[model samples]
Target: MAIKLEKVVETFYQKLEEGKIMGKKCTKCGAVEFPPVYACNSCGCWDMEWVEISGKAKMHSIVMPAPLSTKPEYKNLGKYAYGEIELEEGSRFNGVVRGMTKKKRKEILAAGKLPVPCHAAIYQRDGYKTVVFDLDEE
Candidate 1:
């Protein structure tokens, strides 16, 4: 099981390198878990399979990073903030959103667009592949 779990994580990174966002689809309940897990979070099912997410999501809230709390590894990630993001496939998760400045985020809030459109994209970190979201213009 440990080796299989490692394979799952490895496959996730491999897909990210190819610019495709992958998730795990539960064979039992048909639910999908983004940031893919070895088993189904929705139904505790072990028969999950690889699935590609649509990269479409909605942003519900934003919290800019604190200057004192910023991590060195994230310094290269310009102007990103954390937010509650919901995927089009129906999964909800908190994720980092790139390109969102304080002013832009305020504009989104003032415009009454709390749940603005967002989409997932991969980023090449120093030692790993990571995913982040951005405003979904479409």
Candidate 2:
């Protein structure tokens, strides 16, 4: 199971290196899983295939990271928040969203804009690439 999961991670990073976001779609249930899991969370199916994601998503909920509990690797990300992200392809997952702050979160929440427009972004780390999201401007 570990080896199979490792292969999925490798494929995901390879695609990210090519400037493409990939997800796994269950062949049986037509469910797409982001962060590319080996099995379908929807129907528990292991039959999946790689699919290019649209990189378009919406922020459902946001939680500011506590300063004391922050990870060192994410220091370079500046201001960000962990949010429930729903992809255009119907896959939902938690992801780091850039350009977030306490004031902005309050305003967004007060304005009743729970699900705001956001898009996926590929960020270069120390030696690898990862995906993040940015809130779309009004």
RMSD of each: 1.5, 0.9
Off by over 4 Å in 2: none
- Tell me how far the alpha carbon of residue 58 in candidate 1 is from the true structure, in angstroms, after superposition: 0.6
How big is the positional error of residue 30 in model 1, measured in Å on the Cα after superposition? 1.0
lDDT for each residue of candidate 2 in 45-96, tens digit (9 for 90 to 100):
9999999999999999999999898988888999999999999989888999
Superposed model 1: Cα runs more than 4 Å off: none
How do the residues 35-69 of candidate 1 rate in per-residue lDDT, one tens digit apiece?
A: 88888888899998899999999998899999898
What TM-scores do the predictions have? 0.92, 0.96
Among all windows of ten consecutive residues in candidate 1, which has the lowest summed lDDT? 129-138
Considering summed lDDT, which 10 consecutive residues are worst modelled in model 2?
66-75
Alpha carbon lDDT at 105, candidate 2: 99
- Top TM-score hit: 2
